[model samples]
Every structure is written in structure tokens, then in C-alpha cells.
Target: MAELWKSLPSWVRNIVVPVLVLVLAWNIVTFVFGVVGALLAMLVKLLVVVGIAAAVVILVKKAAKS
Candidate 1:
């Protein structure tokens, strides 16, 4: 494997390899960010639902007291 790598042209070893590494890293980062974004969206939705439920309960309690 070392012999095979050493046989490659200088451009492939330097430029192409770095570019490929960057592309792979970018893809991994994008995927992780997408997952985090999805989780955050779900959390926000859950919070909104809980907020609305709480508001309803408060209104009902207030009405009962009146």
C-alpha cells in the first residue's frame, strides 16, 4: 500500500487528496447539522404544544374561579 501510494503523481497526493478529505469532512458535518436541526425542530414543536396546553388549562382554571 505504501508503494502504491508513493507511486501516485505529486498532484494526486497533494491537491486531490486534500480536496477529497475536505469533501468527505463537509458531508459528515452537513449530515450532523441536519440531524441536530431536525431534533431542534421537534423540540420546538413539543414546546409549542405544551405551551398551548398550559394556556388552555390556565384559562379554564381562571374561568372556574370567576
Candidate 2:
């Protein structure tokens, strides 16, 4: 394999090989970013829910005291 790769011209080794690798990996990169974005969005939603629940508890406590 190394011999076959070495047999190729320098332009194919330097530029074409890297470009093909990136093109092949592009879908994988996009999938990873999409998963991360979804996770972050879910985390934000959880935080918002917790905040609202806390506020309701506080309001209930205040009403009970009064």
C-alpha cells in the first residue's frame, strides 16, 4: 500500500488525497455537529423547565405564608 501511494505523483499525494478525505468525511462531520446542536438544545429546554418549576414553588410558598 505504501509503495502504491508513493508511486503516485506529488500533486495527488499533497492536494487530491486530502481533498478526497475531506469530501468523504464531510457527512460524518455534519452528523457530529447536528448531534451536538440537538444535545445543547435539549439542555437549554431542561434548564428552562427547571427554572419555571422553581419559580412556581417559590410563588406557592409565598402564597402559603401569606
Candidate 3:
């Protein structure tokens, strides 16, 4: 597993993981917000902004590590 990781270029091993993680995290945030937003607010539109911000933060942090 470690060897396989090493075989890839740095951008793939580093940037790609963070990007995939960010996408997955963003999806999860959206799903959770959808369920709660419907119950809590008249509009669920605000959640998209928050989710994008959270996903960007996650991506930035992960990218910084690399």
C-alpha cells in the first residue's frame, strides 16, 4: 500500500486525496444540512454556502499538510 502511494506523483498523492476528501465531506455536509434545514428554516439555501466554505477549509488544510 505504501509502495503504491509512492509510485504516484506528489500532486496525485497529495492534492487528489484532499480534493476527494473535500468532495466527500461537502456531500455529507449537504445531506445533513438538508435534513436539518428543512426542519429549522423556511429556506434550505443558506446551507450551500456554509457547506462550500467548510469543504474549502478542509481542502486548504489538507493541501497545507502536503
Candidate 4:
């Protein structure tokens, strides 16, 4: 592997390889951010559902007291 890299032209070794590495890193970061965003969205939706359920229970109890 080292021999093959050493044989490559200077422009490819310096520019192309670095650009490819950067692209790979960028793609990985984007994928991680997408996963996190989806998880957060699900959490927000779950909280909203729980809040609605609690509100309904409270209202029912208040009505019973009246």
C-alpha cells in the first residue's frame, strides 16, 4: 500500500486523496446529525402526547369535583 501511494503523482497524492477524505468525513457527520434530529423529533412528539393525556385526566377530575 505504501509503495502504491508513493508511486502516485504529486497532484493526486496531495489534492485528490485529501478531497476524498474530507468528503467522506462530511458525509459521516451529515448522517449522524440526521439520526439525532429524528430521535429528537420522536421525543418531542411523545412529550406532546403525554401532555395531552395529563390535561384530559386533570380536567376530568376537576369536573368530578364540581
Candidate 5:
């Protein structure tokens, strides 16, 4: 491995390697953001359902008291 690396030109070693690393890092970050966005969307859906349920319960209770 060391011998192979040493055989490569200096420009390739410096430029190509860093560009590959940056691309890989960007892909990883994009995947993480996608997962977080999905989770947040699910949470918002749950909150909306809970809010609607609470409103129905309150209305029912008020009607019963009347």
C-alpha cells in the first residue's frame, strides 16, 4: 500500500485524495440530515393528532356539563 501510494504523482495524491474525502463526507452529512428530517416530520404528525384529540375531548366534556 505504501509503495503504491509513493508511486503516485504528488499532484494526484494531494488533490484527488482530498476531493474524494470531501465528497464522502458530504454524502454522509446529507444522509444524516434526511433521517433527521423524516423523524421531525413524524413528530409533527403525532403532535397534530394529539392536539385534535385533546380538542375533541374538551368539547365533549363541555357539552356534558351543559
Candidate 6:
């Protein structure tokens, strides 16, 4: 595999890599973002819930410490 890749010309590799990356990125932008965006939104909501929980914990801790 390494020898096969090494046999290819540098220009070929350069062109192929950029094209593949562009296609993969375009698909992700067009398709994967929907699922990933939903997951990210859920993550943000979870973080908010965690933040509120932490604040309550901190207030309780401070009250006890005082």
C-alpha cells in the first residue's frame, strides 16, 4: 500500500486529496449537520441543566460553609 501510494505522482495525490476532502466536507455540511446539529443542541441544553445544578450546589455549599 505504501509503495503503491509512493508510486503515484505528487500532483495526482494533491488533486485527489483536495477533491475528496471537498466532497466529504460538502456532504457533512449538507447532510451530517442535521443530525450533528441536533446533537449539539441537546448538548447545549444538557450543559444548561448542568449549570443550573452546579449553581444550586454552590449555593448550598456556601450556605453550609457560612
Top-TM-score structure, candidate number:
4
lDDT (tens digit, per residue) of candidate 3 on 8-65? 9999978998999999999999999998878777455568778889999999999999
The lDDT of each candidate is: 0.99, 0.98, 0.89, 1.00, 0.99, 0.93
Candidate 1 runs further than 4 Å off: 64-66
CA deviation > 4 Å runs, candidate 2: 1-20
Per-structure clash totals for the candidates: 0, 0, 0, 0, 0, 0
Model 2 — which ten-residue stretch has the worst lDDT? 22-31
Cα TM-score of candidate 6: 0.49
lDDT of 2: 0.98
Candidate 1 residue 62 C-alpha distance from true site, Å: 3.3
Residue-level lDDT tens digits of model 6 in 13-59: 88987899999999988787798889999999999999999999999
Q: Cα RMSD (Å) per model?
A: 1.6, 3.0, 23.5, 1.3, 1.6, 8.0
Where is the poorest 10-residue window by lDDT in model 4?
A: 5-14
Off by over 4 Å in 5: none
Prediction 3 global C-alpha lDDT: 0.89
Residues 1-66, candidate 5, lDDT per residue (tens digit)? 999999999998999999999999999999999999999999999999999999999999999999
lDDT tens digits, residue span 1-65, model 1: 99999999999999999999999999999999999999999999999999999999999999999
Q: Residue 8 in model 3: shift from native, Å?
A: 1.9
Q: Which portions of model 4 show Cα errors greater than 4 Å?
A: none
lDDT of 4 by residue, 1-66 (tens): 999999999999999999999999999999999999999999999999999999999999999999
Model 2 pairs in collision: none
What is candidate 1's CA lDDT for residue 34? 100
Q: Please give the RMSD of candidate 6 to the true structure.
A: 8.0
